[model samples]
Target: MRARSHSPRKPKPNSVMGSPKMKSKSKSPQKKHRAVINQLDYLNSQCHMEGCSVSIVVHSTRFLICRHQLCHASDYFKDLLQSKYGSEDFYVTVSSMSEPTPSTQFRWFVESSIPCPALKDISDETLETCMRLSRRFDAKGLEMRCTKFIVENACSRQPIVALCWLNWALKHKFDAQTQASCLPSVARLSLTALEQHRHMLTEKIFSDLLAAKLRGTYDKAVQVFRAIHRMDHFSVEVDRCPRCGRTRDGMRVKVNADPCRKQIGCDRCHRESCEIENKAGDDLQAFYQCPHGLVPLNSTTDECHCQIPNLAHHLGSRYYFRSENGTILNPPPLSPHTSRTFDPAEDTSERPGTSYKRQTSRDMDRREQRQSAVVVRLEMLVVSLQPEESVRRAEIVSFGSSVILSIAFFYIFTMLNAFTTTNIALLDKSSGCFEKKISKYYGQPKKLWERFSRAVSLCSPRLHSVELGAFANTDEFKVPLLAPSEDCVVLSLGIGKDVKAERRMRDRMSQCVFIGADPVNESNADLFSQVGKFYNVAVGHKNGSFRSYVLEDVYRYQEVAYMDLATFIKLNVNRKIVDQMMMDVEHAEYPVLPFLEKGGELSQRDIAINIEIHRPTSEDLQAFVGFLRRNSLSQQWIFINSEIHPFFKHIRLFMINGQNKECRRRFWEN
Candidate 1:
């Protein structure tokens, strides 16, 4: 069969095997098909090269990526390549994904030559996807890049976007820095907007936002009140030339004594007779000298009636005036000058010499008239400068607005109070304990209930209370109206991320010494150390090593040293009587308070304590009350932090030593 058929098939011109045209036509179709495949399978065409070692399949889309390149770029890929199935091709299938999908993001991330992907051209949706994927795969570099971009770009421009980012970050438990950067924008959102997006925020964050809004409103009200109150009733005294009794504008007569001199002589009389003239003839003058260096009028002219200058005509001239406080006034008053029509028929024709004297006398009378006019103008100016009826009305409106805002704030504060659902028995004042039986107490045993009831009944009376730290996270205390001594000492325990209260205290009492302590050393040292000494130790029940979790971000923990209240006081404060003690030790207050009470450390000093009780149970409350009673501490102020927990989770209590005579004399008696 081979001997018969080998050379016989090449006869036709259109045959694909023999003709060049036929061969070219067949290749053209194949080329077009390949181009279509390359366009449709873009990922494979770009990534499926000779060096590629792994195949990543995202929603049935295959991407052949270089193993070393991808592993170096992503921690997820690094681990995946070292896994059991790493020797074979790897597949990642993401279902039900949106645009700028996981596969596309992965490709972009892998191909990115720069340390961080360029965010300019990337849409927010694409960036969000990158953030999500980076977080899932532990791509720390990409994660940080995305966080920085969102915070710096999105946060600064659009507050709503920033709020969204904040909600997302908070939900995912992002770093504290990221959350803090987004907080300002979130704080700017209106109550309505916040309510609309309330579902997106945590309860704690929502409460904080509301508090911030309230604080802003309060601040604006205070500013308006201050502005209204600062308005003064100003009066101006017009300065006049002693000789001619004329103002600067009316005394426009130049002297010929010296070209460089500002000495002004009377135009009618050639000699300088004003009080501003130098007696030594040195041309030295006072600041109140006449603007045109005018000389005095003739002495014979007893009542010269000089024409008063128009207020607008003297716009370029300087007029000296004194305020009611005896200070020089700038931009002198604009009251209209009084004018009188001259009677031309009053004086008859006279001899030449007598006419000169009569004319000079007439000019003097005109000058006197000008002086009277200036006086009338000054009086009008004083009346005009005084608060007008409209201004008074505006003031009333402002005060009314402030009062309304204050009432609104109070209403909100009271309405937001979330008390425990458990009913507390009434306190028996005589016995200093609850009337209900121990069995009736909610969830507590008999002994615990008795102690709790007794503690609850023991109320620490307050004489005077004042709120310090006007802004967010303020502190209330029983402070004396009189300023403390320069050697005053303040102890701040558990100084977490907030130093606003401390900073305010420092501003009020600059000479007082502040000492702060906290377990987390990250930013506490930098923040607290700016105003006072900072110690990296937790205030607890005992002095030893302990593990403490960060309050701002609960996921983070720190191995820190712990010091009891007494030990901390003795060591850091040099055993000095603490003037003010601020304690916010999360839940450690339960044990630390009892320990301090047992050790009699609080009783030994006349201390003003500002303490925050966190997540207190009925037993804890009883113990706290008992501790205060035993220490003879009077509760000066109390606030429930609804932001942390809606149901009495955090209680801020301020107390002062009632037994200490000095404390009573300093704060309560005053």
Candidate 2:
């Protein structure tokens, strides 16, 4: 290969190719030739040298590289050099400009002793150049190294930078590890950032990221609720106004006069008067003023005679107040000397002049009043905080209920939407085959004319249908849009010149595998081959030679090899289940329908049939409807193509095997 000419210039100080200038004073041609050979030998044995067998010229620079080394390292090089017309003098040019240039990176990659070079020493630009070259050359080793570097280091960078790397990896179809490692960066991204870069991500990745975010938010909310539940047991104390003697707490006021009243008194004297005037609201005061003498108090101080005993009893027992830190705030245990007596007769507060009966009544009333007052205060505190606790609990319950309902509604909507979109039609057995009463046509029509009219009027019970295929010509067909399956197999019984319907089905469901058959081996083979496997034989009742006619011209016919439906299915499908079968064999469906019914193929598995019945007579029509009814196949869609013959119409029908258990489970039970 010829190297491009360049102006003579001094070599850079750090050039890997070294100085290109050499001088020799020897006059003899033999000595100069020997010196040139020595120079080439030195270049071949250098650190960057792979071999001196082939020259790779990149612009003005040329490098000697080995063919075997390049071929082993890259698929592109292997295929190029192993081809019939490949020459040893071919040149590889690197057009893109980089810091070290593509030529330098290529030389380093091929000549390095290790499979992967030390990436830490290489600059980012040089690494990027290596990745580009590796992908371009289909170098698996280099691609793996690049992918490893990205997976290990990309997420450690800024989120935006990591997202850029992730987008690049996804676009290039990197390994799953690389994609997984980059997904964390997506989770770290803010909502606004994700929205801004949403166009860069695939739909599945975007949804996964959103789901992760929602899960995290829900977890945080749960943590908050747990903290609230733990801290809910703390008690709140209300401070009293020194002058008015009214209690005040945050956003709430409790007056001694009217505990349930919302409004406050106008002045301190008014509050005092209100407190003295409203005896009904104060249970303690009402107990004191009871005219029936149910409770009695000391006339001097108006204090309960059993107050000390009640306080001592409460403190010594299990009834203890707890602080915010859950520590017990009960007073010190009562000493034997200071402990009050529970019996009224042993009390020290009894007067010497008091009668025994009066003293007993006064002590009992005072003890009861003190106990009631203590109970009332505790109850008031509990009632005050009950509403807040109820509201918080309600909030948590509401949140949980909403989440459960949302999930249930989503599943219900998804199921309903799937059924609705499929356009499924369930059989109405009570309605009978025709719209009229079954008694009206109880027996089969005796006359041929009556039978023909009855067959024409026959209406298969269909709930709904969806049309699919090209709208232009007779290539258009209708079938229920069933759920997609990954391992779906479709059998195409005939292929004339058009495969529009098959192509549309493939577009809708790319996972479906199509096996097409046709008698003529003309353009039909090429057209059907684009979508799936095409067979040159025809499909019929039995495996034998059959006469087939062209759809365009019924008179033109040819003898073709034919295979039975069971044999075709067994040969192509391992599971013996055909998801869909499309047949348009001129007028051969009349004989094929009987074979399918007698063989019990429709009963064994779920198979959706889309057949174009060509030129059927009254008897043929009646037999066709009878076959469908016997096989438990419900018609989903029917089209009459009367363009060819008005009297003997070509009826196109799509039916599903409703009797099959698997069919009902997959299409109806959902």
Q: For residues 168-203, what per-residue lDDT tens digits would candidate 2 score against the true structure? A: 777777776777787887688886678568767776
Best candidate according to lDDT: 2
Stretches of candidate 2 off by over 4 Å are 1-425, 429-475, 551-555, 617-622, 625-648
lDDT to native, each model: 0.56, 0.58
lDDT by residue (306-385, candidate 1, tens digit) is 21233323342234444454444444344453221223223464444666677787787688768866975765554566
* lDDT accuracy of residue 457 in candidate 2: 37
TM-score of each: 0.36, 0.32
**Candidate closest to the true structure, highest TM-score:** 1
**Model 1: residue 213 alpha-carbon error in angstroms:** 2.2
Superposed by TM-score, candidate 2 places the C-alpha of residue 592 at a distance from the truth, in angstroms, of: 2.0
Where does model 1 exceed 4 Å of error?
1-53, 59-79, 85-88, 111-125, 170-180, 195-199, 202-204, 232-235, 238-670
Candidate 2 lDDT score relative to the true structure: 0.58
